[model samples]
Structure formats: structure tokens, C-alpha cells
Target: MSQLGTLEDLPIGFRQGLTATNLVPLWPNLRGALPHGIPTRRTRPLLWRYSEIRPQLMEAGRLTPIEKAERRVLVLANPGLGLENMQATPSIYIGMQLILPGETAPNHKHSPSAVRFVVEGAGGFTVVEGERCPMEPGDLILTPSGLWHEHGHTGSEPVVWMDALDLPLVFALEASYCTEGEPQNIRNEPDASQTRYRRSGLVPWSGWMRPPTNYPLVRFPWRDVKAALADLASVTPRGEAVRLAYVNPETGRECLPILGFSAVQLRPGESLALPRHSASAVMNIVDGAGVAEIDGVQLQFEQFDTIAVPTHARVRIENSSSTKPAHLFVVDDAPMQRKLGFYEILANEALPPI
Candidate 1:
């Protein structure tokens, strides 16, 4: 019995004199008092929100400049990060890294498709398969699944970015593989002509240049996507008609063959339903404000907010305001679905619990 229980057996007037905090309500007031008496607020705990965790992320977001200098691979959240927590997800794993310039994070490669978004950086470059591309804020780079890649900093200051990969997905499929990558120039940043330079712009498909490889030649900048949406303001972003599907520039399809990726624009207070109905998708709110509802459970999303929409979960994405548009990055195996003749069916109605 709690101290309150001992208190309950005291004179009735004795309990009345105590403040609500002094007493705990054990059962619903709907029911009469129990043999154990009322439960106290002391026994009930409060809920903590993610916003409450921001300070932790900020404080925990520290990484050494790079001691290995040439053979460096410093991960931001180390012994305290609890990376094993990601295994529970089993489908997607996301890791954030804060890399500084003048420090090369040793050249290494694994059998996984990795995507890097410049969370905070300037004039950084990533050499993938011998191709070096200029990196800037909001630029996207890919170290294709099972390909050799290395990183080198060119600017004066530090560069921090988010590293997202299909590690969990691969692990779930039991296709996980890793190894020390072959070193081409562990200490060298070769010329661009000798390697592939991702155009980050549209390429006119010339049937003669050779069939398109799974990887494409376009990098959509955050600013450009916003501008494109501004030009298309007349259209509503709700139905599939308003949704934009990203495709390979050469093939004009998703970024990669099996790994599909697209970007969408949402005006504040505006919303768009999940267009590719049955395919699973992971969306990162690049910019603007919004709420993502899956079967009536609403999730408020802002810039850099990521949400995973599992296969066949009826969902609707909405913006909370109107001044700014919500730009989002969507990744799914849409093309692969089509190739497998498994284009998902659109869930016309989002079902909510009674």
C-alpha cells in the first residue's frame, strides 16, 4: 500500500484538507473509490516530446575534426549513439554525420546504396567511382549500392551532412555486405574529366549516347524545386495529378533502377495524399510546414522531418500554413514495382478508427 493508502484510512476530513497533488487517483473517478483508495499524481508520469530531444541532438552532435586525417572515419554519435536501436526498424536506417573540411574521412565502401544530403556544409565534394562532384548546401550525392566511393574536402570550413542508406532494408532482406573498399587515390582528388560529373540538370536523351544506366545525371536543388512549384501554383498538390514523380534524367524515371526517389512541393496548409498507394515510401520534409496523417494518427512535420509510409497504409500529407511551400524527398522502389508489374493500388479513402 502507498503512503496515500495509509492516509486514506485516516479521518475523512484529513483527506479533504490535502491538495490534489497530495493524493493520487488510482482508478477512474467513474468508479467509486477502491479498497486501495485514490491514486496520486506522483504515480503518473508525463509524456515527453521529440522537441524536448532537440537540445540533446544539438549537444550530442559533436565530432572530432578527423585525427586519421587521411584514413579518418569519425562517426558523430558514437558509444552513446545506440546505433543498435536502428536494427529494430528493420527496413531503413538513417545516420547523421558532422564532417569537417581539411579532413578526409578515409576512403571506404560497402555493399549499400548511400545518399548524402548537405545538412550543413559548403563547397564539399564527394568522389564516387572516381567521379568528383561539387557539393553545396542541399546538394544530393549517391554512392551507389555496392560501388567504390571516397570523400575529400576542398573548402576551408567544415562540412556536415546526413548519411541515409538502406542498411536496415538490406539487413531485413539478409543482403547485408561490407568490406574495405579498394583505394584508388586515398590521398588524391583527381580531375573531373577523368571521372563522372553528375550534371544536376536535365539531359536531352540522345538515343545515340548509349542506353541509360541505372544512375542518372540530374540533381534537383531545393531552390529549383520551390521555383518550379511557384510556377505551378495554379495546380492543387492533393491528388496524384498534383504529385511529382522523380525520374532518372537519361531514362526520365526514378533516380535509380530499384531505388526510386522524387521530390514534392506543398504550400503551407496544403496537403497531398500518398500517390503511389501500395508501394512503401520514406518522405523527408525538406522545407515548409505540414502534418502527415496515417489512418487518422496525425504527425506534425517541418523541415528535415522524415516519415516512413509503409506499404498500403492509407495516408494524407497536409501543410499547417500557407506562406511557404513544403518540399519533400520521397524514396521508394516505384520503378521496380512497375517492372515487377506490381504497381500498387491507390487507397482512395483514408480510413480512420472509430
Candidate 2:
């Protein structure tokens, strides 16, 4: 456990030694007061909780290190990695969570970049790099690492989303870095800039220049995904579904390296075997029930369900219900892996007819 210190003169904090968190005092300040302190000493501070962050939902307040441990942090990326390694590779880190109406999370930032893809609810938003983007249930807001950001709800409804970041990979490589700014909601002052930058990128026209903004884009409004599906209905299998992926319309590449996002709708009792190879993925059940056979794990899932499959593991998604369609979001690290030339897909063996 390395210590949490100033950006430069690293303080021996958590992993190393922690007389106390550096949230307030610099190392010299504590050293100057304690002659009893020896060089490179080790001391245990208060331990915090890191269980499933499900209990703190619907509540927002400033809690001490001990109390803050209880709050839910929807980390989407790998659980533990540092920034140094994550820089060489690509991944997201965040927990998918839904905040109740009127609740607000304070300001914070880190060395690994982050984006919030709202999974449910509406009316809450995230303020990033000096701009506030209305958290409209499905908008994708971002906070590039090193930028200040906060989340709050001024509207009457709750806000929910998948908190995606590269922290796990970062923290794993021990390149973990963090810097929290002044809390935003304690004052409740509205900033007009938040809404302006929520969407500052260019619409991909010819796979050319993508407009510049904090994050390139936020592809949501599931209705739009549905519309695209309808148009492909005649061409797509009625028993199965369609998944065209969210791409950099202009570049025709990927939104980012290591994270590929897409959604689909499966017809009632429809079963389709999707060939699989390199991309490791997680699927979230949004609207219906289904069975996902991934690497031998036949998982039956309903709404609010989550399932993860390893890369190159044989996989297939099937809709087991006969009454309704199943809608879900499938995320992976494929497109980027393709750019690295390490992408692969293993087709199911063709069986000889009996």
C-alpha cells in the first residue's frame, strides 16, 4: 500500500504508512509536529469499507473516510490496476449505479479518465472540466483524468448510469492518482456552461473530423437504437436481433480503444448463436429476460441483471422468453484490440448432420 501524498513529493499514505490521510495536511506539516516520527515509518490509519456499494444509494452527504466507505461507487472498469499500465492498454472503471431524486455526489478527479453512461432515471447530471451536462438518464458525460467533476440533481427525478473509467487498470499498475476539488452542490449555484459542452463534438459526416469536446459523444436515447433496429428488421433475423455497434461515425473506427459499446433486441423465444473470439464483454439486461451461454455459464437473467464473459471464450446470446423482446447493452474491448492486431473470433464448430 503506497501512501497518498502531494502530486510530486509522494506522501507515505495508505499502502506505505498513514498517520492520517493527506486530505488536509501535507507530509512536512505532520512531520514538523512529530519529532517522534522516524523516517519511512509505518502506521495504520482508519480502515474503510469496500464491499458492494449498494447501501449508500439515495443518500448524499459529506462523510469522513470511515463513513464515505459506505457510499456506492459504480466502477465499470477492472477492479484494481494503476494508471501506468492502463495508459499502455485501454479499459473503463466505474460501478453502474442509480442515485435517488435530489441526492448529489461531491466533486472529485483522478489520473485515469472517466465517462458516465446513464443507465436509467433522469434529471441528474455531471459537471466536467468546468462544464455542466444535464444527466438526462441516457446522456454520456465525461471527465478526462485530471479534470474536476461533480454530480447532482436539481430536477424532480433520479439519475442513473454506468460509471465507466480506466481506474482499475490504472490503480493496478500503481499509477493511481487523484485530486478532489471543492464540492459543487454545497452552494447549489447553477452554471450555464454545463449544458453547452454536454455535446460539443461534430457529427461524423464522412469519417473525417470529429468535433472536439471533453468526451467525443454520448450515444443514447435507446429509442434511436430501436429505430435503427426497425430499419434492419427486414434484413435481420426475426428470431434474433441486431447489433451494429456505436462507432465514431466519421472515423468509422471506435469511440475509444478497449471499450466497444452496443445494444440489441431479441425476438420472443428467439435463439441466435453469435460467433465469438477476442472481445471480453459484459451484458446488462435492460428490458427482458434471457439466457446467456458464456464459457459454460448458462446464466438466466432479468432486468437489472449483469453477466460478464472472458475474452476469446466461446459465447452466444439467446432470448429464452416467448412473450416479449429482450433489450440489452453489450460492452467489450474488441474494436481497440483489433487496431492492435490481436483480435480474434472463434466460430462454433459445424456439426455433421446425424
Query: What is the lDDT of every predicted structure here?
Result: 0.55, 0.55
Clash number for candidate 2? 37
Q: Estimate, for each residue in 1-354, the C-alpha lDDT of model 1 and write its tens digit.
A: 423345446676755765444974443342344433221211111111224333444444343335434332223221222444452122344455545556566566776677776655676777776666666666667777766676667787656555656665566677877666555543365433223333435343453277767664434454555555566666653443244555555655566545566667666556566553656556666667667776455777766655656555567777777676667776665555687796767646743321
Return the lDDT, model 1, position 313.
58
Lowest lDDT sum, 10 consecutive residues, model 1, at 39-48
lDDT of 2 by residue, 258-320 (tens): 566777777777776666666656666667776777555566676656555555555666777
Off by over 4 Å in 2: 1-71, 74-94, 137-147, 182-214, 238-241, 350-354
Steric clashes per prediction: 12, 37
